[model samples]
Target: MWFRRDLRLGDNPALLAAAADGAEVVPLFVVDPTFATAGTPRRALLHDCLVALDTSLRETGGIGLVIRHGDPGDVVPAIADELDATSVVVSRDYAPYGRRRDAGVADSLADHDRTLRGVGSPYAVDPGQVRKGDGDTYSVFTPFSKVWRRTGWQHPHPAPGDDVRWVGAGSTGVVSDPLGERPVAGCTLPEAGEGAALDRWRRFIDTSGASDGSSRSAVAAYDDLRDRPDLTGTSRLSPDLKWGTVHPRTLLADLDASGSGEEGHTVFSSELAWRDFYADVLFRQPHSAWENLNPKLDTIEVDTGKQGEEKFARWCAGNTGFGIVDAGMRQLLATGWMHNRVRMITASFLVKDLHLPWQWGARWFMDHLVDGDLASNNHGWQWAAGTGTDAAPYFRVFNPTLQQERYDPDGAYVERWVEDPSEPMLDHRVERTEALRRLKAVTGR
Candidate 1:
């Protein structure tokens, strides 16, 4: 079993499939240089995740996880040829780079008379599966979500049954040096790995049982408190989800097992749909990863040049001075995460208030976020910049101060992150006006 994002052994469809193929399934993890250099926070978290996976595999199956570095196209086939394995199994990859890399590996395997097979994916509903009755990909989230719900998903595949045999594990050492060992100067990251992921999920539900739908307590309040950044209202699960420590199917199943009729459950499920939606969008249009989904916003002038560089530097350092924007950026800079509402606010501030290109901020996020999946991060930035499919309309620029007044009602969130904020970089009102003017100049819609 080749592990990419799916680090955990539980509820992993591909691993189970590999085990079903009979005993002595070799588990391998390849550390690609590109993936490792992507960012510091995720790099560190990924290392911890791999360590956890090694421990879990060792304790559960008494197998060693083969750690490799460099190109998988060569490394995977080399390992398969060495083991004389008939096939290599992995969860499907939807990201452009991952897809290409897997394809290359598959070809190499085929040359050696071996097969590279895919099972389920990291998502409940894999991308390129859900579509409209017309059979075209849905660009708008709501209609896509409707069809996605109607299509539903398969039950999570069970873990490897007890008494399964394993092979070819205890050989090479896992990578010790990740991109960076330290997190941002003052940022605190959550505990890493599968155990930590399950623990967080258990606490969020505030109930435990293999089957007890009526015992749920915490999720019931999700809809009420999810938007409040001041309180621990959200499930802090994105990073885990990104790493595939816990699958979306697992979460959906547990939510169902905990009674699915609640508004909180429905909304949280929809959020998962949104994640899949962005992945689907990127799957169909790989260019959208770095380019605009909507062309109208392409002509808009951004504050780029030396002045823009300095402004961007301030934003990256969380010195923007707008209370909520500063706090949110600091939250990201310090930690590799930010509240969703604050994400939108800070994104809008970067694109509209700072008059910078959305790509600048998006790149920064991909560098900082432990959960930065390219599809979600880039599309989300586009949504805020009004340059994406079914995006926030251009005229609706978010007012950061007003957002703080509304979401950070008690100022607790802002105060927590921005101990000594810099002066307001620019006036929001003036920037908002200028933003509208720029949009009008480009599209005239």
Candidate 2:
């Protein structure tokens, strides 16, 4: 089985399909230097997950994961040819780069009479599966999410049965494993791999309302406390979801069993739907990854000169002087992660408050966040900037001070990350006025 985003063995449809296809399955992971730009935190998380997966392979199936390095189109087929494997199986990749890479690998495999089959994907509902009555995609999230829920999901597939063994067990000699090297970022990353993912999920499941009414379970208080970063209100599973350590199907099943009718569970499930919605948006409109979904927003004058750069640099280093924005960036720099509420606050400041292009901030985030998936990160930036599918209105700029007052009411989140806070880089009220001026000029409203 060729592993990409889908890393874990449990509830992996691709692995089960591969095992069912052949008596022995070869667990192959290619460390393509092509993706070397995928940020230090992401690389480090991937490396740790690979090490964890290798351990699982040996303990469970008496074999190790095959470590290969090169372009996947060349390396995967060559490895298959060496093993005389009949076919190569993988989970579907929806990202533009991944889609192109998978196609190339498939063509290469076909040249040698090997079949390349894709089974499940990283999402609950595959892109293009849910559409309007007119066979059109929803440009808004609310309608899309409703359709996504009504579409339903298949049951989680069990992991590969105990009978499946490794095909390239002893004969294949490994070389040049990137997973063996440590990432340069040096930020202490979150727990990595399948076991760690499950353990974290268990803790999240067992978590209950605290005495202060702060901490809560996934379905218990998420609706109430999710926007409160000080409470650890949101699930820290995005990194795992990004790496597919735990499939959305698995999480969905558990959430459904826990009672999807409850408000907290329903809202949490809707968030999952949003993830799928963004993926679908990116898949169907690949160029939307860089450009705005609504073209008219391009008319908004975005600052890109040195002055804007200086402002942006401060925002990135958590020196924007806005307590919430600075807190989020520092949290990201120190832990390779940040709270979702803070993410929105920081993104809004960069695009609206700083008047910088959202894409620049998106790229910066991709180079920093461990859980940065291109679809989610870029679209999220666009959402804040009012330039994406299901975008918020252009006038809906987030006021940093207001956000701080509302979300960080106790100032706990801000104090935790910003030790020596700086003065406001730009006056929030002034920037808010300028941002609205630019929006009105562009929209002609």
lDDT of 1 at 374: 95
Over 4 Å off, model 1: 171-186, 207-216, 257-260
> Lowest lDDT 10-mer window, candidate 2?
168-177
Candidate of highest TM-score? 2
lDDT of 2 at 360: 88
Q: Each prediction's Cα lDDT score?
A: 0.84, 0.84
TM-score of each: 0.94, 0.96
lDDT of 1 by residue, 1-445 (tens): 8999899988898898888846568888887868755777887788788888988888887766777777888888988887888899999999999999999999999998999999988887899889777888888999888888878887877778776767745534322223234333235677888899989888887753212234546576777777888877788999999999999888888775233488878888888999999999999999999999998788899989999999999888888888888888888977889999999998999999889999999999998998888999999999999899775988998988888899889999999988896678788899989999998898885
All candidates: CA RMSD (Å): 3.6, 1.9
Model 2 segments more than 4 A misplaced? 169-178, 207-218, 257-260
Clashes of 1: 1
